[model samples]
Target: MKTSISKAVAPVAFVLALAFTLLLHGAVPFWGTPTLGQAVWTTGFSHSFVNHGLLPYAYDFGAPAPASIAFGLAGAYPAALLIALGMHPADAYAAMVALWLTVAFVSAWWLGIRAGAGSVKSTLAALAWVTMPVIWAHSGYSMLSTGIALLPFYSLAACMLFLDDVQGSRKIGRALLYLSSCLISVFMDGYSFMMFAMGSSIVAAYSFVMNHSTRRRLLTYSLPVHIAGFSLAYVLFALYIGKPSFGAAPLDFFRGWGADVTFFLFPTQGIHWMWDTLGLSVPRSHRELFGDSSVWKTTYLAPLLIAGLLGWLFTFSKSRIASAALIIAVAGLYLSLGPSLKFNSLVPQEIIETGVNMQHMPAELAIAPTGSALLSEHLPGFKNMRASYRWVALAAFGLWFLLLLWLSKAETLGARSAAAILCLAVIGSNLPHPQRYLEIPASNRAQFKAIDTMLVDDMREALQPGEQIAFLPYRNDFLVNYLAPSVPIRTYNIGGDKNLAMARENWPKTMRQFKMNKVDPAFADRLLWLLAQGEADAVVLPYIDMLWAAHAWPGGKIHQKQVQPAIDRLSATGLVDIDTREYYAVVRLNATARVLGQTALQAKLRQTLCLPGFCVRQAASSNAIHSRVGRLSANTLKSDGRRGFLVFGPYEPVESGTYLLVVWGRAPVPAGAWVDIVSSRGSTVHAKFSVPRTASRPDNILLEEKVVFDEAVDDLEVRIFAEEGSRIAITGYELRLARSGPDKD
Candidate 1:
């Protein structure tokens, strides 16, 4: 009767555990918040899977395939199928998380049963493993980390290969299972694969060392099968991903992610409040030692779970599985400390002040570096192993596995009660608040849909084949910015600064045309030129200020003061603002305007003239004064005094030509103030005009002069000679080359 009851309880417990796991993760069937950060990248992968087949080369605005070889189609294909079935991407993602958690729980139970636990005990163990804090945290951030779902099953297969006595068909089956699990883990996530491989190596090494017969068995039976498995997986990975590239990173990159020793002893963030009242609180400084330090939050094990681990260590220390778990846990903890030993709040000030100086060390100790640095520097693949805190997952797994192993040996009522309590404690400790998963706002969703309709759908329908579009003030997050546009159009300004750099290098003519001395012309010119060159059919300038304000947490007002100048300058060019919405402006280059041969056309220049107290003076070699078309004016203008003359140019015509020069001036001029066009060859005044003080509208004055040059003279100057008390301003000028021909000498 007791046996039947226990059997009945196991299945019920498993079901309850699955439901609880979903509830804990907020992955309750069809409803849950979206995972943030790296999850966006995963959604992109799914998008690619839906649009193209598996192993797609490009997606997300044509960004090069993102680590897809390692990431495989494990989660992507399923999400894509759900999306095809009319589930929203967010809903589909939540479903995938649920499926991953279910697999993980079942795999844990299978491993426990393989390790000799009874049905009821293994079910409890599975529940404990599913609610582990590290798994929960990883699930919320990186979906790829869900590859840990396979770790337990793989560990079970490794045990059969290394420790168990199996023969013939069973041995072959175990070998095949081990190989498949390894391949699956590798495809699921590279980091999880590393953790599994490391633990397996340690277990295998221990087995080989224990006896000569075992070493021979490993050499003959295990090594060959594992090698073949690894080789096949590698060949497939290489074919899919091409050659892997490794880049060197700074020492600080390795150091910053190291786990603190105290993290293991303290309660996790979920239950830290309980510890706070007891005066055993973990320091805030330790919790956030680095930006990625939250990944290290997995170090917490409940007191009861820790007690179970202690019970196992004391009672079954000599057992092969216990020894292997111990070895892996210790090694994982050590490795997770990273390149140097800086234990957050625990490290002494003296040690920090002294720093690490290997130069003065003894010869034997000098060569042997500690922590992950030795492996990262010397090991080929280990250098790429960042986020050392992630190694804590292995340590956590080993401890939990040991706890289950110890619980399996329970026979006395007291021991069984203790095991049950520990299992409950584990679940309680890892129950995260639902708010951890970031909520996607309805307004943000609406905004994205609107942008897709207005920008993407409209542009796709309007543009001719092969025509492209550009987004101004480029953002690095363009993939997320324009996620799932209705029509597929190749986009520019997606590369951020790199795209800007390419524009600067390749589009020099455009750059020159928009170099108006007032502002940074690179942004406006590059965008306009991209359109002018027919590289793009339209330019979408998202009202970035308004967009940011609308998206700001707690809300913010739009401040377009800084970006307004760029918008105004773009408008000043021949690009007409075709559509203006609350969040963006769609502008297109005017087909009729001669944007290409701008240097050969008549150029207009304008400036504000001085009022009563303010005066204007032009520099002798000002490029601003140069006519954009004729290239015969100057721009070097400087303020003279509170009241002074406004002078422009020592103009030099490119060719000997008859020219029409028009000048517009506005000033409060005295009687003696006069405007003169003087020749550089002599002080001969070509034209002069005196201002009358009694003139009703002296501020509104226009002067047009047609000058004939006998030769291509180097210098012709325009000067507003004002009297001492007079204030005259030259508002603007226009220069045009005579239509017929140059005046002959």
Candidate 2:
């Protein structure tokens, strides 16, 4: 191939990739775009940026912080720019996906040619990479898909920066490229960037020990870029998002969602056309045989790539990059296995015995704890990175990179023919059915109906600048968040943060209390306090959102059942103006209500206290704890004929004085129950109340005691102890200051 022709192929190839992207999605109609699920959040964020210039410092489910800490902006910026230039938000999002995907193709093509593969082979390989089933699997998730597209560019920059052969101005250019790539990685998807950093470290370490020239380049261009890139990331995150850490994922979650050995070699059930057309039931059946459906199967390397990698293993030499790729690939696979060693979705532990002749059985094999599980439990970064199977992203890249390097060496006819066969097989195996593309719903249909019908000017007039609106059924808010930008309203809810608690999971109990007929005054008071604490100026019940969510989300039925009652109770408050619409309702909190809520909340906080169930601690694995008003729903704790402490709290008193403590609850089993005022540090119980069973309401007071503290006590705690066979139901506790003066002897 001619040099100029080869140089021109990348852009020409991008056009082709863009066309394929559009065609695969059946072309975007003007009324709606090709996006759904998580894509809605990115699109909504773009709308916000376009209309209000709002940058979210706190994400959904995350505490208020800097916008730079999250992943949406990378995809959001371009979409916002397009929206600013007059494209519809939906169209902008579709175009964004096309643009990033084309970049991925071009970047990989460029990298392959630079690595010495011929233009024809490189083009084919790059196209194959773009067309992989895994890429399409994340089509709706803009962040990860964009990050995936950017990976090849980051790798290319790394190659250019560290190569001893490239010197002078080229080295400087590479350094600049490396810095930009690093910054992009930070803003794009932190997880993918972390994986790249880890993979690069392995390569650099290997290269440093093996070659003198490589070591020199590492010290020069590489060191400076690392310092500049990392320092910049640290400073930005420190100032805005606080410390940079991945979301804390639980150990069990990591194990459950981990990658299986078989997935790496076989295609996932639904993605490939062959599984259905060829009547191949084994692929679906086998996956279901070993583990639950939770185990991610999106990391499949197609048959062609797997074959090429297996072949490379036998013929590979001591070349630094090639050897490093192997090591990185292996490490990625191991880490992706999570805390347990799963082979073909089954654990290996015991050997099967047949009449004294022992035989190993794959089904019986089990490994409870893997190194990754231990690391996730204790190690900072490891513990935070709960989705261990995402490590397979690095492995896939390494294998592709290695395959490109291997293809560059193919000169003979026999070698070329073998390469052709593999390439053909890859294209055939990975080709998505056109019907699959047709299944994607139009984006306009998914949007909140209120956006089109509601008068933006009228809504804006109703709300003040900087006033925050709290949306009921918080999870459904993202779908309607597109309205926020046009109305230019500030909201308490954040979009695009999956780690946040699902409103459906946490709101049923609270909604029950909000009912007009069966309203709990104390609980209502607490909720009003929570709203005041959240600085919510208004509450919006998106009736249309509930309708949309009912068909699309898990908790629609509950939201529908409970929302009208909530509206009735809010109207009953008589503290605000209610704008009831056909599709939605907005209950604005007036100035008087805000003041009263704050005052009442302060009074309640001073004396009354409620303890959360021990089960609530399970949320620690998620990033929701960072939020002040994070969801910790009301729950009941039950003991099965065992004497134990049902609830323990390190609750401190507002002031040191004599107080009347009353535990409001009931013991259905008529067993003995007691309350203890204990020191948080030492195992010392300062006060106790052992009361006999009595005929009372289910949620009535169980025990009461007058406790006195002479001085300020910082480490005061309450422990609720129950006797064996006791079925205790504890609602809350009241600690009223009995006297203002100090205790007199």
Candidate 3:
């Protein structure tokens, strides 16, 4: 009963702490974006995991599939739960926050147990681990949130080491278990692996000193197998992290996290006092952290007192102290440079005139060192360790362990009271932070003015179930944000930042150079290919329109040629076509859209809708539509409650420049529509359809088809009529134009 009760204590505390974490992120509309001390790593991890099988869209570019099935599955946990229970993304994300906390709890408890810490000690250690100021920082700071997950696994590995040591087992079973953990750490992150190396170094060094006589025996036999297995695993997992460049290191390593460790416990600059007290802040510097929280600031609680008191009062051997210090040093350095003050972001990435002058280093730190090779040996599916921030977690865990050790010797109430006083003194003296205070609960975070309404209904309406898309409302796009918790609903897309990095023959061409390939190597060919393959689906193309400005294209096209090799393979299957961007949505026909649509177009549209197709407008009415999507005519049953003009087309594919679409119903560039022409070679040209500014104009909306064509083409594939199947009614028609030639520059 006592053991059970002890076990329950940490878990219960962890649950409460996690609940607090979720509530801080907001409950319903989970649109948390981490700011200064912004968690880029966390963002990447979450996105790569959540949007698992979707095409890459406007934002979520450069994301990779979860290399490992084990812990990499963390990203999908929240989405799966919410889905299982029929919950919304926001609720699912909130639940994820809770789930994340729970994972932290379990991991911490397991770590303590592994180390042979008694049940009570393990529980306290776990509680202390979750409540660390850094963990609190991540909670209040959404950007850093995903990175916290690494902490638990890290703790687990450390504890495993402790247990293995205690058992003094050089047996094969124990050795294999240790090796398994080494493999598991790789899936965690690149930094997690580094920390594991660091921590293991400390342990191994200590082991060497303590067991000097038996050291050779341990190192020669079991240790060799362990080391060999580890070496082989690394080569397999970290394939992408090829040839390291000792360039600049990562800034988050030191700056962003400084405030998390030493001072500014809740230095939420500029936020009110209430939230500050609860550990959430609305600092101007980290707006991404607390901007949406109108009611309650993202709240967090720092365990400064607990950690500090334990550090000062509890006595441990020199080795334990060193372990704690290393963790603090590494995590503290990263914090100091990141959230605390400033971070270096610029790197000269200019490609050389001859060969590439690749300055591939991240904004702050150098990529991991090289000598290592084998991915299968180190991390089969993923790198077990990375996310340097997790070291802070290990630091917290180490501190708690020492405290528990100290607590064990206490004989009376006086001794306990003495220890508590020491702890209180440390807590009181060491903690120096300004808190954020807000009147509302953090649950009611602000979206846009109508964002709450949109999330409740509009977002759902916007997305079709099983149709993949990214939902972003952050500095970066949603693919990089919401996808982490929403993983498995979709997959990573090479559409955004990565699109440029990608090419079509793009698959083989783009992937040929990488150390290890994406899970589905031929997975390249852009989000377009994946969509075509049914391996990928839709993209929630974020139409950058936050200011209520017109939603227009933020120009940048996908390079299908990069993944040509992958495309070639897919094409062989005949599920995909070899030529013409029309078969793939990215380079296919463009659609002229509005907020609403007209009666004639609506009739034509209903008939033309295929199992799935694209829209290409040949012409439109001259009247200026307000750019909405609904039935424009009064008699039609279709109506968008919010009236405006109209927009149409999830268009049908055109034969690129080969198809000459002569618009007769609407004049050249009709007022109600945008005449967007995409060439066979994948170039786009646009002309708006609007009312003529000419004086002698008679009709309110005259129909004119302005003829525009490529001077280079000898014969264009002509669409005989405006509708896909109907004959022409004949009025004045406008010829939609495309640019003259290949320079597409």
Candidate 4:
């Protein structure tokens, strides 16, 4: 009776302690949500679910699919529930993390009991699992961190599937647990899914080899279930992505994001504040740590766990569990080292430099690639995964299992005392500094909330429900996406999903034309003409987006100088009415726009051949020249001494097929410059012609070229390559369709 009472009381005590620790860390159900990093991204998804239900648009102006499923489907239901209960999206996200963390802790403890640990040892192992530096460091990343938290649960489910000696209802329950865990694991994140798959496969193979009795059970129950569960999960994931392909992380990402061996021993970065406060700063002062980023340096293991792991490896233990643990731990660590070996961020230099023996030198940073490279290139699942450091999660779990084994062997009072100390050491070593908590100030949170409310109200006032809208500088999406949850308006500005990133790629190309001192009349007309055609009911220019784009674009200083002029030009087109606010402007189609159909709009946009000289960018220099000839004045950009690209750009999106480009510009004689129609960045040249030498006093040389675009292109530019020290002046140019038909691409 006393023992049962103690077990009951112990869990309550653990719960209280866990809550306090999470509170101190500013985790959710305790405080405000984080305002930085991936937290905002996670919050956006929760908000979408709360407002739009399950099949909300992912991004790129309502490209349909719940893109969040690819990142955090495991946490989506909980997040949605919290948000529905009036929690802020950020807080809801935090609550989801806290919930998973609690589940992880409970699962670890349960696994310990199943592994024959006493109550005290079980609690310690569970404590150690949740408080690992890797776990805490990744908490802000939503389901990625939750996936780490769920690893123990997955392990527990796998153990039961292979080793449990149950019958009838109990056996069915175990199978259900295994299936549920597998589904949740795969839904959580790819890293967690792959780790679970790898770890479980190892266990299954071992059981098959050693336990002949369990082989039929595994083949009959586990194999079929694995097939069914993984197949269903894949179909669900494909539906969530809305396509067969997922966002492909770049190849170099694998090399850059790989783990450093020393980071496993070194304290992670976020704990320095505690050391500084205690005057124990030396441990945190190392400036030469090798890793891609501070965030990736989160594989720190407790010193006690490391000693235990080493002891288990060296000892002559025939325990099958211990052997499996060692094998898994080594495999995980080796794979996490990625395709190279790194030590303290230092690489060996050539021995020839100091007349030192080559044998005395440290190994070079990277080898000429290895088996991991081949796996990443050719392996099915690995090809999609780039962050090899995440494999350390499996390593950490294996180490935790070894620690539990060690704990189970300790039977005396002194051993229990040592186990308690181990738990304390794990918690102390991994405790993140208070400043690491990404808590938003109450005032800032309230301010943002108010801004969102006002923006929603403003959008509603400007447009009717279901009206499609487009935001200017189209990539400014976080606030726009947040607004999506509250406003009834639909838009093309979706959250940052890579597949849809190119949905409106042509908008920037058109907007880039305005970077010059003055907007072209033809360009301004085209902008208005597109709007009048009703692709969207309105265009919103948020003050926040305008400010961001002013500094975020290339040649931003030039963009800043040209913004007002471009706005004025766009407004003067008179096709749409602008409703200006202090924080935003709404451009709505007027009565005149409603009457202008496709044919009239096309005729309006087809004002060809009047493009001015200032429209052509002087790639060599930014300075412009003003000249008057009789009654006519020209704004021309002169070339500097630099040899390449004296004139280029007005990079406008154009449909495929042949087009005529006419340039009225003058240059030094004897082929001083050559003009061509080329790809946006001038990589592919479509047509080229030499500039005609002009003996006239006034700078007027007519050069025309016919360029054929085999496919529709987003950024097509007319370029001029100049000889060194060649003087050139571009007066004007004209681009027109070589074939007469309505645009249909």
Candidate 5:
């Protein structure tokens, strides 16, 4: 029965997985390469800085995410520091490549081993999967940090498919294991699990046709709970953790989703943003548009990928499950395509009631689960993403599995069939249909290094401790947040899809970019006109995104004339420079970072006063208390002087130290006013005093006595009451506070 080969495959796969895990751990385990899509996720990790544990936002900037989510990825920092951090990120990724390869290999071995294939045949299949076209793509370049987790999940799913069971606890245990595995797979990265699910589903359908009794048993125990558990897990994550709400109209729904319907039956139109914030339709052309080249490269590793598809033609006939899996794979593509075809453009049609455009589309609606339940495989990290392409992966895995099943069953067919299969694989490599997307690693990084230096140098020269240079026009969150991680640059806004204040502050140019996306001389002239209105730290202009949508349409001529020229002007007081090196542009911010770096400003003051990176406020103090009194039942200057003080005080100090001075006393029917002060260094040294509030003046406002300066003050004067009454009832009061010294000294 050739059991030796079967035994070797499992251990070989395990060893391979371990090796890849070591690789992915990389040279520097602590400083690992971040996973794909995690660049955005990294931004989400800034929520831990609160005085309290969890806050309403990340970086205190945008809507909050669930706790312990993104923070866990950075755990490597602490994890490496605490435990013997084995692999560097590079090593971890290397391990991941090996891990997935091992998983695919083991899965194939298990497939043949269980199908009565000789141990040798099973091992051969294991080798086949290790070097499979698409799978090889995954091994060469893994994307998820948890790519190592896929192996256990695939093993778990394989057990349910091939093993014949008869018993109470064992059946229950298997079901739980399957369900738990499904949940874990999803959590790793929902998208990948989605692929896993698709491939696994194909195996199930194939089981249904070929092994009817086993299929019935599998269906009886598996279907209901699997569907329920997956749904619940999905909802819990999406609703609570991700917090996805219906976004502004699905505009792309009307466009064709895509013509390549093999991934699922769904149309391709609305797929671009399937799980994104917008959840809208996308262009079909984007199928190969390598937004992130690394991700594309990983997709090519599926061993039985199109180029290698012909290799299985000989085995296809013998493996019913394989054939079914392929058919289901074809069906799964239509899953996404179906929604694209049915995408609901927010625009109301005559058939639908007016004002009630049902915006629910493929993304908003459930499409994959139907096919997913039947043809899905458990992919590690699938839980983290929406179940879109899972069915496809499930079908592919099923076909591959059945191929091994047939290979193992074919002891009588001899070496000819085996040699032919190898020949097909070699030939398949060149046929090429599952082409990998074009990759330009530089595309992942923006060209911001040049201006980063420019910004650093500029702020160093011109900034002062207390003086703040505000960057107008560019989004404070995107520009300032990304740039001023260590600096004290302030912005007027943060984190919104588009910051309105930034736009309004630079209205003339902003409006053109947002709505028109063109360069009009008039618009440009208007912007230049606004620039002269006052001196700003630096006014940033629009970049390409402004015109990427309707708001920034007339971007062409207007950008050239109004936006570009205004940015170029370096009149002595201000300078115009391009921030395009960072992939976006904004006005100059500070005269210099060095100057700003060494300011009199307190870091705490910056947090309390500035919104993340923008200077929306300041602290200043002055002398003079002007008050207004509203008529109460008792009215003017009357009744026991129990009045409210509409007092404005010394703005909070830039340095937040503390001294409390009380302003209290009965307003003499008419007493002369005397203002006194104590030396900051000396006690009770009278700075200035007018005649005690006298009847002759009868001023509208009253100043309290005993204005003591016992300690260094954080705030200015506090309103005090008459010796016997309640709080200061005066209508209005102003407290003048300062560093120290007699006026006119």
Candidate 6:
């Protein structure tokens, strides 16, 4: 009667868990920002491949083909198909999530059964694995890391093949199952593949030590399967990325991302609230570290789960599987600690002086280098293992296996009842609060509509075939989401340092000229030349101010100030503003380089009247100068009673010629002033004049200066210096440029 009741529990628990997971994720489709952004990119890529037959590896960004090859297309391809069938991208992505969750649950249940647990125990084990906070937390942020969902099934297949429990046709079937799982895992994500490799190696080593016959079977059956799976994956990788290489990352990467010992002792904030209410004070610094190492927090087994495992260990200390699991768990925990060991509240004297004191102090504490760091320094490939906390996936599999093995040995009803209660406790402990899902804002239907029409539709209509476009103040997320499917139009951004380096490498001459000449003025000219020269068809300057304001972060204010000035200058050039909206403006080359240059020059001349403090009033549509000290104007331009200089025009010259600058002013008393005509490409021209003191107030004094540029100078800076206590008023100023070349307007 007890056996019958227990047999029904596994299937019922599996059903309930699956239903709950679907409900939680299905309702809120969007979770993490970065993950959603990447999903949008991936879906766009897949759609482009299916519709236009473009190469999957080809990217608008600077990656040498197949940069995403390692990311794999398991989730992307299916989502793409859904999109092709007219489903929304968000809905398609949610569907993929549901599918993965289902697979994870079933696989976990199978693994539990394989470990010889009763129905109720197996159900609990599966539920425990599926609902682990680390898994859900990863799913929320990095969808790619969710591939760890398949590790349980992979473990089951490995056990069946390596342990040689099955014979004849069953053994061959298990080998094939193991091979397929390996291939599927590789297609899921690179991290998942790494986890599989580590877990399988441990199993293989254990099998070799335990049975000589098993070792021979592994060589004959498992080795070939493993080799075939890896070879195929390698071939696919090599096709896109050219050659595969390791050690691209530094040793510091491995050390920095390693798990800390404190992570296991305290749960993340999502689970920490319960402990907090119980008066357990978690250090702020420790909490911060927990937040940083969210993925590493996978090592945190619930107290109930830990207790069950401990009980199992005590009861079956002599069991081979139990012993092996203990060894694997210890090894995984050690490696996860990374290359260095530092307990909470332990710090050097120098660090302590900087005010970075440790929180939640314990009496005994020490710090030292770890075995992982030593191995990583000496080992060739170990240095490439960045996130050491990821090793907890292996530890999780071993711990759960041991728990189930112990449960299988308890035949009495009391033990079964105890196991059932413990399993519920495990579920209760690991379950996330409702607030966790709501922490990240979901994308509304209206936002998606705006993205489709404002960005996607506009780009499709504006760009001609084979024409490329560049985004001013480039954002990678925009390029990936909007332009990935538009194969006819290539996109570029000066967003990341890597992209900037690639741009410099690809256009050495253009970059060198920009660097050498006037940086700001020449920047606009270079972009126009690049466009007119057919390097790009259009430049899209989005309403960066609004975007930054909406998603405010550090440096947002700086970026906002830069956007308007850049757009204003770019618009001044003779490029046609084809599409103008509050959100964005698209500019395309519509005139000859000389005409565009002249237009830009004319715009600069018009701005001369708009100089702040110097031009005080508008009388008869001309600026009337007023000079005063310590009085604030409505425009907020005030003069202090001291020597000061004012600069105007870092302007690009239209043509090579002589120019006359005339300043007409009157002074109540004699004062000294200097006028400077500075060329970015040539020598500075200086002129000094004195305002003559008069018994009667002077009407006006005329000062004229002549300057010449041998060539069309890229930039010019005009400056005026006022002497201390100089009471001078400038009524009018004029600049006249002579046309020297036939191309001059």
Task: Name the candidate that leads on TM-score.
Answer: 4
> TM-score: which is higher, 5 or 6?
6
Q: After superposition, how far is residue 399 of candidate 5 from its true place, in Å?
A: 3.4
Which of the numbered candidates is closest to the native, going by highest lDDT? 4
> Candidate 6 on 1-745: residue-level lDDT in tens?
8778766775676677777765544323443221344445455555555554444543553322223433546766666677677766656666676777777777777766665665566767777777666566565333444577677767766667666566788866876787677666766766667667667777777767876766777787776766666667656644543445333444445555566666666664545435545654244343334224454445566464374466456446445556666666667667776666644523445545655433322212335667676666675334545566666666665666666665665568887566656666666666665555444325422344445665567666766654566655444332333354543455543222323344434542332334421224335655555564555667666554322222221113344344556566767754555466445567776655437475563344334422211111221112222333323334332235467652244343434565556655544533575556666633654333444543333534345665555655445545545678755444445554633323232
In order, the Cα lDDT scores of the candidates are 0.56, 0.58, 0.36, 0.61, 0.36, 0.54
The candidate, 1 or 6, that scores higher on TM-score is 6
Tens-place lDDT digits, model 3, residues 575-610: 333223321221111122112223433333333321
Q: How high a TM-score does candidate 5 get?
A: 0.44
RMSD to true structure for each model, in Å:
12.7, 8.6, 17.1, 7.8, 16.5, 10.7
Q: Candidate 6, which ten residues in sequence have the lowest lDDT sum?
A: 612-621
Tens digit of per-residue lDDT, candidate 1, span 1-745: 9989988898887788778777666564344533433333455556556666544433434332233323534665676677667766556666776777777878788877876678777888887777666776666445545766556766776787887777889988988888887777666776677787888888888888865678878998887776777677656655665555335445555656666566776764444334544565454443224425464466665464485467566446435667778778777778876676644433334434656431111222122335567786677556766667777778877777777877776667887687767776676566554344323323333443454554556545554433455555544432332343235544433222222233334332332233322234345645554554555567655554322322332122233344467678777765445565444565676654455344322222111211111112233344445321111224322233334445545453323456566655544445476666666653766656675453334444445666654454445666655566564444465444553245653
* Regions of candidate 5 where Cα sits further than 4 Å from its true position: 1-105, 116-124, 130-163, 166-168, 188-220, 242-326, 332-395, 413-420, 423-745
Error of 1 at 733 (Å): 25
Candidate 2 lDDT by residue in tens digits, 39-112: 55665667766654545432322222223324656677888888889886667777776677667777888887
User: Cα RMSD (Å) between model 6 and the true structure?
Assistant: 10.7
Preferred candidate (TM-score higher): 1 or 2: 2
Which residue pairs in candidate 2 collide? 57-65, 339-370, 347-365, 347-366, 348-365, 348-366, 349-365, 349-366
Please give, for residues 59-97, the per-residue lDDT of candidate 5 as tens digits: 322211123232123222222222223432233332333
